[model samples]
Target: MKVNIYYGGRGLIEDPTLYVINKIQDVLKEIRVNVGRYNLYEQKNGISMLPNTFKEADAVILAVSMEWYGVGGLMQTFLDSCWLYADKQRIKDIYMFPVVVATANGERKAVEDLRGAWELLGGRVCEGICTYVSNRIEFETNQVYASIIEKKAEEIYRIVSHKAPMLPNSINSCHVEIPSAGIELTPQESEQLSVYVADDSFVKKQKEDVEMLSQMYKSILGKKSQPDSEDDLLKKLEKAFNPKEASFKAVFSINLNDVNKTIVLDIDDGKLKSSYSSSAKADITVNAGKDVMSKITTGKTTFQGAFMSGLITAKGRLDLMRMFDRVFVFEY
Candidate 1:
């Protein structure tokens, strides 16, 4: 009788999604159901470990805010993490209820996406909540709205308690399987790995170890290790920097498939720091081919130009991308 609620909305004071979940939580508590809640915003660092929580949950509520057109990235990341690390056997039996609250448009589409995702993960999709509320106060104060939320909670309780039967879904019937992350880990181990993945210091240490090993192997083979062209580019970026503001920090993820490595650049107050690693939290993340990166570093192409030409892809804050060119005017 344990139900988990993962809130995938930004913690806004006036978010209607928060109001609805709170109401549902209260009703579930009154019915003596052991309810647990996880706010994805507060757990961004260890989202990859969250799928471990699914082991004990009989049912789960995937609640998210459709502020723009789709479910926020945090929820989508959580779902991706689950696909990568969760135990599919356990997921197949768990019931999933989607709670989508929209402040703009696309609530219905978001709901469908969530349900389809859950079903694809082999979870039972339950009829859940979906609505748009331009006026949070009005929606929260409406008695009918409150009643509907309470009824939904009651339905979950009865269905879970009685071991409700779920109709077959064609997607699940196809026996599609997602490959695991290739390693089995306990919950504690998964949490530790996730923490290490997000910790920049830990990743740096690992990179140092790898570099040391590479140098040793090169010496044993009687050959010199090739100079890291990308590393030189990073130093060049630092030398060319022109500071605009007093204090600012941003991380850029540059993928170089030629060297089979990803470079992370951390700029703090116009001071440049570079490493060969990954960061779960970055102001802006870019995925570019080696040619695109080479062109940008050589000043043959600009960040904006590469993006417009579909040579470089980026996500996160757009402002950071614009700021990069101003800070570092690359000259070949």
Candidate 2:
């Protein structure tokens, strides 16, 4: 069996919590158990990444000193990190024993807080050691207190060896609701990200990069989704007009099928006049989709080529129909 102790006290000379955990550790180790201890104050820089140590632990002793009111900041940070980075399945299998030593009042409340946190974390919680020791030296020197500590440690060993079950309570039923983040990670990736988060320099550099990217994106202007005007057909017609030297006279009704627009072109003596009209009489009526008209006007295809490809149909004289391309030739 393996048990790990997490000491969150500030290592003060007058801290009685340290003495209790040390005595407990000694009793547990006397039974030939693999034991380890992590002092949070010594490794404060990487506290966020400490949950990775839970992989091999069968049980954990969360020992904290209550100098003031609540559990210390170090222990709270460690618990927050476990909630963020620890594997939920692994946590469900590990047992937690809380030890809260109080110099002031509120020892019972702090113990309840510790157990509540462990229950919320989906871990099994065993009965813990909570006491008010105003005089550290007296608490440490009392033979009766030492015997009680040793017996509790042996009880911890028996609980683990027997694989005791945790009773289901409302606190255990309440699920942990983690806040949403930008990206999701697997267990391994979450551990790695926690390490990065624990490093001040890494987090600072990442924030700087993100700010730069945000400004870069804000400075760029993208094209609008909708066009500003709806006069593309007329504009193309006006731009593609090419006057002829010969004297020619013709009236052409060009109907754009898709757009439901008809363009009437009147050609007389090498001059051209255009108008949009629903009723127009012409020597030739050309019918085509707007795409075909755009292709012909843009010099991509000619009238004769389009007619042979069945892209356009005309209802008038073929001679005048062939003359349609001559007066309105487009340059590249």
Candidate 3:
């Protein structure tokens, strides 16, 4: 069934909360569910006024934050705009779920506001999940929240997977609320909260890198196996191309941008090996462990941002880097 998720928020002011929301999408995809996600921040009006892709979806989940007992300004505007469609029956039949990111102090208020908004739109209000991460939690601790969000996402998927053929008139049947806080944040204390907003510039760069690397890996992995006695450099080339029978090969190398690293990939087997050792020319040749390489190739890292920030570098044949796209096909 078609599934669409709408994420409306201001910015990445809190890393933990943002991490949780982002990871939830990954979890849904891992289970083979087709999901279309839209971030209100990137849109011109913060709401898709045109009939939303969510129209035909069996379920539509909205991820927004509560600042005090109210929805964030951006999210408020977005919801108000959505009334145009929801009121007209565009998304009237879709099951609606809300996920609110909030701090322990403001959790109740935030959730209440979200419920009010959901009901206002003639949408069913599912149980809401609240994720709390203290301001003191280091950004590195975000993984913890990611896991929590993933678990919450799993519960949501399960609910939608087995939803009653006809939802009851009541709106609370499908809500799953989670209120979390670090051990230090006592139940009584009021803590300021933040959500991690992905760097728009970085996310765009990362998407490009992931696409490039994914293509490279697919190409090399597609060819048949060759002899072990193949030239040493040729063997390395083949290994890079056909690592463990992967369909593509992504080679991380130094990039021209001081802030980013360049990824070179071999998408399909061609005669490129004929010029093996001329200079081994790639700026900052990277020899990543298989696991690390896989992550990079799969777009788990912000390659351009990493490179620009000095996380990656190049040494030779930088100009030939653009050849990657010509080598492999993008699967998605």
Candidate 4:
């Protein structure tokens, strides 16, 4: 498995975060993981193009130092570039592990922020290292600390190699649109602009070309690609129905998290009635993001598998919930 490490910390002699990431990288390499490391401080100029590196990565380590209150400007800028220029569909399939070492405070919050940002992009998250160090020499020299770091790295390697399933996160419920300066850039164009950003002649010419027209288009070209329509999803849900004789009657209220809509399935023996509304109370209330629901509809994931993985959540009669896939059978 290929694992990429993006170190957002400045290379300081006293930065324990640097030491931790090095240890993790070493452990990962010892296990024969194909590893790539990029120090963002050194490559600050090319960060806009860095997202393209996700192409070969099965998982990534987002290591940032909390020198003060947050994950620092470099990491934040890198994340912003990923949201604006990266192929988000590619990001969704990769796993992210966050490593934060704080000299002051807020290491846990920084990790949370990293996880939240990645999840907003629809990626999986693996557990990572978060710690505060008072003395860098003491922290790095300790054998126990080294052992723990080794184990975490090993665990991350195993997870990525296995292509593990993760519980769907809360970020699935909310996201902000990535605003564009002008046209939606292809990755190559985005990389070219990073070099052009410093050239006055190129900047002036590009701005002149986009000037008034940029405002006219606003975010028209940058708007997020939408998922399947509510009607289309509803039809798929209905079409997948496979009546079961054992259950006398059942009602399933499913919330499509991303679209902010709920669909109700009222099943009475062989008959089925499905519709959408803002509110729908039922015998079993299921909750999942649009992607998860699509998988269920397409028979890509079973209802039980979704529930067990926490991709699809159900409230009320969980026993009745287990019978859902049986009645509304989806096939490959």
- The CA lDDT at 112 in model 1 is 96
Preferred candidate (lDDT higher): 1 or 4:
1
Clashes of each: 0, 0, 36, 0
Q: How do all models score by TM-score? A: 0.56, 0.55, 0.46, 0.55
Kindly indicate the candidate among 1 and 3 with the higher lDDT. 1
Question: What does the lDDT come to for candidate 3?
Answer: 0.49
Name the lDDT of candidate 4. Answer: 0.77
Question: Highest lDDT: which candidate?
Answer: 1
| Model 3: per-residue Cα lDDT over 118-207, one tens digit each | 665555556646755456265436665545555566556655554423455554344534234333422322121111122356435545
lDDT of 4 by residue, 42-73 (tens): 99888888887887677899999998888899
The lDDT values for all models are 0.77, 0.76, 0.49, 0.77
As for candidate 4, its clashing pairs are none
lDDT tens digits, residues 148-267, model 2? 887688678767654567788887687767677754666865656554323345435645755664453344213122221226656766667676755788888888877677888887
For model 2, the stretches where C-alpha displacement exceeds 4 angstroms are 175-180, 183-332
Question: lDDT tens digits, residues 75-145, model 1?
Answer: 99999888767777778768999999999978999999999999888899999999999899899999888
- Superior by lDDT: candidate 2 or candidate 3: 2
Better of 3 and 4 by lDDT: 4
